[model samples]
Target: MKHLNTFNNTILYDFMELFHSLPYTFLGMEKSKDAFESAKVVLLPVPYDGTQYPYKGAANGARAIIEASRHIETFDDELNLELEDLGIYTLDELEISLESALETIKRVQEAVEEILDNKKMPIILGGEHSISLGAVRAINAKMENVSVLQLDAHADLRNEFKGCKYAHTCVMRRINEISHYVGVGIRSMSKEEKEFIEENELDIYGTNFNSNEILEKLKDKVYITIDLDVFDPSIIPSVGNPEPQGLFWIEILELLKKIAQEKEIIGFDIVELSPNSNKISDIYAAKLICKILSFSFFSKF
Candidate 1:
């Protein structure tokens, strides 16, 4: 691994403490991307999970994930590179009051638009899958040449979930309206989603297909989003929407690496972690987010 060490070879716990003390700050320097107004990568945290049925902790998912990121080393052994040096800006959590899901999406859309207008790559920390509707819509409006990669266990292609068209169950269906999306790790689906999948011929699937194969089939640029429920409920049970079976960390990393190698990821997000005092789950979410940024932005830069 090509670790360009900037910090001293300090203790891991000390490093975690440093990262935890200021969860969102870059390098313990009270650093803000405000200085680099033209930063390429932007991290947006949306901690609202207003409509999550039976699960309430996803509302705190963004904060918990950010907190856990402190212990993450800058270097990624798999990618053989260091992160953080690439100038990925972490935005303070967006103000999402007790608003309707539709309203929250509008708010998220505006926030993502501001970041994208500056030509920055947005890595959104989602409150729910619905938040993606706004971000994807804005990105679609700005750039017509991009594709969406929806990662989750559920198809999320239903026309509506219960009475809400904007439920997590329909998030990808919403994405279908804005962009050509390819879904991976979809093991669950509503009837409407099944109908839509069959009618529209969506690439929603259950197995870990070859990333290179998928990449070759896709266009050159992509927007990657992950709803943590994509992993099996066994390993990552702390999600708002838990599923029966799913992908492992290495499997996910491999696909992400291939995407980074083969395409330009215009934007991305990791959402739906619903931690319940399980420190490992929160830490896992945080470290995974850090690892993703490392492979997708930091390591490459």
Candidate 2:
């Protein structure tokens, strides 16, 4: 009996070591049986931040988020559920095209289309906000009556920026051409974007807007695009363009829960997480993703 106990302990240690050494997955959980086929949610990491200018480290955001995710506990105390049960599968980081921003976006669109075809929900970890354009395009192609819910500090309504239509600043402009969108948490924008918003009579809500009013503007099917800069810089200062006076943690979570109950979240992306020396920002972003997933899919569980 003593020999058997020693052998079992040795095996357990080996198994734990192997698990920890494996390639990082979201929440550091073991893959489920037939991970891709059985997974209700798939994480598509696009580590291409070619369009980001002025601040350029956002290309490293996706990997940082994945690495930080390994440290998070899988159990959600608030929801009283295990997040690992959701079968979240993380795909290899997408190979980015250095040729041009448009080519990269095209690749993103193709990747997202395949995920949608498989009947899996895609949670894209973006290199920058521009990647959301591809995911939105893919979603719009397959589903009708889709509206984009953008949570960001910038309106991103510019027709072009730095001679690139697909630049991170112009992502929502490209998306607006494809589908209707509503912007929230907007406290920064150029005069061009402001004029465009007025000219188009767009639905953009600022920091003080009512959540219920915003909900009324959304359609039955929603594709959410979250730029980490939407959060207050004091809470998450590791974004490409951190702005002051942003949304707090609880407020964002509460709104997400309300949306989860009210509408269908087709897919979502969390972008512009330029990781710095602050490890807390990385962990916070990882936790935010898990919480959003928990709220989005809590009904299925």
> Per-residue alpha-carbon lDDT of model 1 for 1-301, expressed as tens digits?
2353433445666877776665454332235546457456677889888878776778788777776676566566876665655666678888886857888888888998988888887878867788888899889778867888888888877777668888766788788887898888888876776887998888776755777667866778888889988876777778887878688878887888788777878888888888787767777777676666666674445
TM-score to native of every candidate shown = 0.86, 0.92
Find the candidate with the highest lDDT and give its number: 2
Where's the lowest-lDDT run of ten residues in candidate 1?
1-10
* Number of backbone clashes in candidate 1: 0
C-alpha lDDT of residue 170 in model 1: 76
Model 2, which residues run further than 4 Å from truth? 1-22, 31-33
Tens digits of per-residue lDDT, candidate 2, 125-179, equal 9899999999998998889988899999999888988888999999888998989
Candidate 1, lDDT over the whole model: 0.76
lDDT of each: 0.76, 0.89
